[model samples]
Target chain A: MSNATNLDGAITLITGAGRGIGFGIAEVLSERGSVIAISDLDADAAGTASDAINSTGGQAAAFQGDTTSQDSMDALAAAVLQEFGHIDILVCNAGVIGAPGYQDRTEHTEADWDATFGVNVKGLVHTTNSVTPHMCERNTGRVVNIASQAGRKPRGARIALGSVQSPYTVSKAAVIQWTHLLAVELAPHNITVNAVCPGVLWTPMWETIAENQKANNPELSELTSREIFDLSINERMPMGREQTPRDIGKAVAFLASDDASEITGQALNVNGGAVMN
Target chain B: MPESSLGQLAGKVALVTGGARGIGLGIATVLVERGATVALCDLAQTACDKAVSDLGAAGHSVLGTVADVTSRDSMESAVANVNTTLGGIDILVANAGVWASEGYENRPEYNDADWDITHSVNVRGVVNATEAVIPYMKEHKRGKIVNIASHGGRKPRGTATGRTLGMPYSVSKAGVIQWTHLLAVELAPFNINVNAVCPGELWTSMIEGIFTNRQNLVGGGSGGSVRNEYDEFMQTTVPLGRGQTPRDIGKAVAFLASDDAAEITGQALNVNGGARMN
Candidate 1:
């Protein structure tokens, strides 16, 4: 109700902003008058998101950066700094849930585990490490990590036909822990670090999961993938409603705003009454 | 005090346990500032009355009630009195809590009374206050519950005075945090959002007393007062380079109590200036 989170004239860099929660965050923050830099692994998607914001009279630019590559992050930070002067906010929203692994951890391939951690855990580190020095030098910054509810609670075969193995959950848990460590480390520099745990957003990631579930089980072939996803949401989400990308984005905006100056080192759950931790 | 920028809590009735002083009073102040009528419940009538008079002089709608949070009967009675005077409670800030002074080195000698008192006020106190407000909130089908916990519950950290305050205080806070989670799950059906705010080392009388005890325990041979030791500890331990104020904790409580946090439940939000992150 209180739209006092004034981001006027601030420069915000959001990773994975081509779509989903990251794009939602970029849109809302831009509406608050912040200059946005939309970075994603997909160059065309980033360009389109940036173009859409720019067409709406909001200042925005697109950059292609892979979170898994430290060099790419550094380059992205340097380019953004060169263009916008300084970055006041960084939202680490890039993450990956590996292909459904074997039911047991022992049967899971090393590549599967590495890929999950590579994008979720190590990618977050690369982006934070690249941008924090500039923020520390300026003595002000805000970092919002988009973690998931699975990070706080074990998914444990909750999806009707879908299976979530250890790699994704463990990586998200690591992101939460890393958010804590970075929050403490950056506090002295006046940079606030926090994590947002979103629950059951109908993003491309979930669509992929739903498609995989429909394909993996022939018993559920009659039901569409979207129907299966809805069933999972109805069963797990206590609010009896699906969470939107904007819901998570609003939460990220609140944490990054000046109104939340006292809030740091906290992982706020933006779920629909699921995984209350 | 600064004017409340957002009247998000206007027309809401708030009841705060241990509202005589410290964090509870701070939370009550914020709620009242946000245009909510507040009821101050504390162990003693004198302290509650004094606090009410002080806050009343500021042109706020506030009442004082004598209630021991450790006793369910007293809490229930206090809630009844508040409902009769201020209307049904829309928000409950369970801030009543206590700490143990025994050192970890002397854990063997620590009596059962120490542990009992700590758990009674910190853990059971939250339960008593929450239970009293549930029926009123259930009738309305809407409410917000903010439990005051400590950073000690989230993770291990040195005391403000750089002394070990033992495990009872941390363990009790952990119980409070866990209780918040379980209550959030159970009460979700009633549309009551239950959350906890874990304050870091705030400069309160309770913490000042701990600092003094630590100074005395070290025999004051370091040639520094308790305040100085606390300042140094804050400088080194707290990444923010300062201890939190009561208002800091109060603002967090106000946030969770507002409709802005409707979707947030079963959360342990740390307001310790990055002392401990969970």
Candidate 2:
């Protein structure tokens, strides 16, 4: 598809950009002429991703930052601002789906809840707090949060991944609500905040989920992990297809561009007919 | 406005149905503010002209035309006129809708007239507007359509304290949402994005009328005003602790109409202050 966003000369910061949806967003933004700053917990993976982009004639820099830590995000922000001179967009893509034990609320641990919220909710706050000041100083910026369709509706037994009672689902719900709250608060700075809700992406997160489901459910012992994943996607997704990281990247890139200036405080669902609302 | 600061709808032509007042006028105002030439279509020529004059007084490029949304011929004629005068209809805000006053008490025998009026204006009206504009949009291979729906459509039918949006209105709005989804898929190949905006508890004239009717129905000897009832409902229901304004709805519509929402389709965006998350 032709790129409609004019992100040329823009500086973008993406958390968890080492792989999955974050890396996809970084690659798309780089192709659109953005100087990408890849911040991930894995320093080596972040560096490799940044090098790959730079080798493709794109401007990119890698920085290691733990999204769950405010101080780490602050340092990452300073490094990115110093290198790029100004930050134009911030994509909050770092998130965590708690362990298999966290799927059932009755059996879930407090630690599981904390881990999920720390990365999904608090991490969002840290990154937004760190970079929004610079955006407010310049009176312009874009914040695209990668939320999940699970936030919109509870996933019952229809999906084999995250349960409706899981902390991951609760955390994503918080992310969507936070998108609304922050959009209202930051609209005056001309900084648009929006969330992209992706449906059933076959990422490393899904691989772990499939493994856990197969291990726990005895009826699914005959099925391979890939087959189990495909079965879930086919049953749950109305479009009968799984979403790609690039699909999410395209949605984020559009929201980050100047074309979406009037769009703030909205959650755009990139799910393939999974959750209409 | 500076060239850079101009809205994304600059140089675009838009047609908003039922634009004489309420949410329709709000959508039209925002479109005009964003530099689009807007045509306000309503059933009454006098009201349409007054709305146009009101917007024109603010130095906006606006026009008023008479077209009954329930009548396909009227809508086609109105759209044809807008295409002739405004160059072409690049954006369509199908805001023409009507609310039935019948409550759940009359659910069994809800007058045929009441139900027909609600569906005719809300459901068929949206279809008429979309059908009228689709040809122009398909020929151009570019368009944006925003349908004004309500939170009542998303929620189940039940009257709790302050929640009394009539069952017919709720059903009609639900149809609007479903229609928006189906049309979005069909129109995507044409590059036209179709979406619905569901507003919650806005203090519009229509809603004020509903509150007054409710007060008359249940007020009895109580000395409470309808405004007080509305305030009470907002406090108990809305998480944001307040109701949304027409401007909030307008801004959301403007965003969906803009190129910023180019990839967004088959979606119903709720701008109801977190009252309905889904």
Candidate 3:
């Protein structure tokens, strides 16, 4: 059994903790008594999110960092470590959806693929590199990478877009595989690494996806984004319900807890059963 | 309705096939603990009665049924019994399964019997249970069907069972996973959610039996106890370096059965302490 079981009073660092799922994770973790270090590319968003947590009676600090830049991540890591004394958990939730999957397009633009990969895949690596050293120094840590159900053999899952969001989906796939590789690498250090594949949360990313889907599909042009989202939910989601950010946050919190110390190199799906692979 | 979850399956009638012991019992116990009136359906009346008694002693609502998952008629009657006795079949945990290790020596040496039994019990059994409940669920317009799968169905483990090579059991589990997908899609309009839970490296009697047999046939006087063999495999393969409890599998089944997973369908969730992740 590991001595670190709970997230109570642990110092944590989260990438892209500005809003949506990232903020959702931060809030849940903070409620669990962890001091949060919120990082985002947008300084205002990061600060506002941190402040929101603080106002909610959770300890938090804000730092501006772009996950695509290793140097920037490294600096942000240093600042967070200095401010928080140590980083017991690192949540690499910063991600991009790339281009909205259009029904008519066979593939996405190169820039879309690169941008999606840059943030979703490589961004995770950069952030992991930034925080793992401090964790390695202490010989204990937890890493939860925010992945997507789309990344896990989701080709046949219509709710996740069969041919759409390829770049984003593929990049998330890479992130999951990378989580395994990193978990193996960090397991010896007592550092558990995992991924959380959220199902269908109506976050900003999903809004974009719904908008693009409706825009690209002639039949859906008359429908609203929320309506399109609902249609996908009703037709594809067996539960016929939308997933909440809190659902994903709860999963991340579990993986980060001591109870999940034995759970590593795994991707936990928080989707409402849309994609189960 | 989707707001309820985890510990809130109260009053829901849950039927667990092969629920006398092992993983099936594990799922039944959890569902019972969560306040569902559980019907334990197994092949032997004695085993089912004992299981039901043990659960009943704990002050939970539970019943027993002697039914074979491989037989559609038996399953249909069992489902009907559950419906009449417990009011309705709200959730069905298709936990009955068979693992064929009698064949596959080096590289999947498939035996005719192994293939037949595995498919008959693991794949077709799940389908039978699901089909038996579909009419009732469709009539009720609310249901959750969770099929038991294995990590072997998704990918080969790097060690242990992986060394046994891909065989009938793996293929049969693969079928269950696929069928879950199809059923999830087909049953969506009926407000029924279908999913699969793939457990990894649990040390159940079935697993203990596998290890003992494997040691006898493969190790040839390697002098390791079954538990020792299981521990060694967990150490080498599982990143978490641990074996999962049936309770762990139960938690997953309960989650998928609850409103918490209302949007989740056709998913194969792995509950094996990171032993297998694909």
Best model per lDDT = 1
Q: Which candidate achieves the best DockQ against the true structure? A: 1
- The estimated TM-scores of all candidates read 0.86, 0.67, 0.81
Error of 3 at A69 (Å): 3.3
**DockQ values of all predictions:** 0.32, 0.13, 0.29
lDDT of 3 by residue, B213-252 (tens): 6676668333778789888888877776778887777777
The alpha-carbon lDDT assigned to residue B38 of candidate 1 equals 89
- Give the per-residue lDDT digits (tens) of candidate 3, residues A121-168: 889989988889888889999999999887888455354334457788
TM-score of 3: 0.81
Of candidates 3 and 1, the better by TM-score: 1
User: Any idea what lDDT model 2 has?
Assistant: 0.80
| lDDT by residue for model 1 (A1-277), tens | 2333557888999999999888988887887778999999999999999999999878999999999999999999999999999999999999876745432223336776888899999999999999999999999999999888888866455553333446777899999999888888888899999999988878888776676666666765688867977888778866566777777766776687766777788888877667865
The better candidate by lDDT, 1 or 3, is 1
Cα error, candidate 2, residue B272 (Å): 1.4
lDDT, model 1, position B65: 93
Which consecutive 10 residues in model 1 chain B have the weakest lDDT in total? B101-110
The candidate that achieves the highest TM-score relative to the unseen native structure: 1
Query: What TM value does chain B of candidate 2 have?
Result: 0.91
Model 2 Cα lDDT, one tens digit per residue, B1-278: 21123455787898998888888888888778877788989998888888988888887768899999999999999999998988899889998887773453323334666678889999999999999999989998889999998877887634455444476788899999999888877886677888898888878777776667676666722457778788777667665456777666776777778765555677987776556645
- Candidate with better TM-score, 1 vs 2: 1
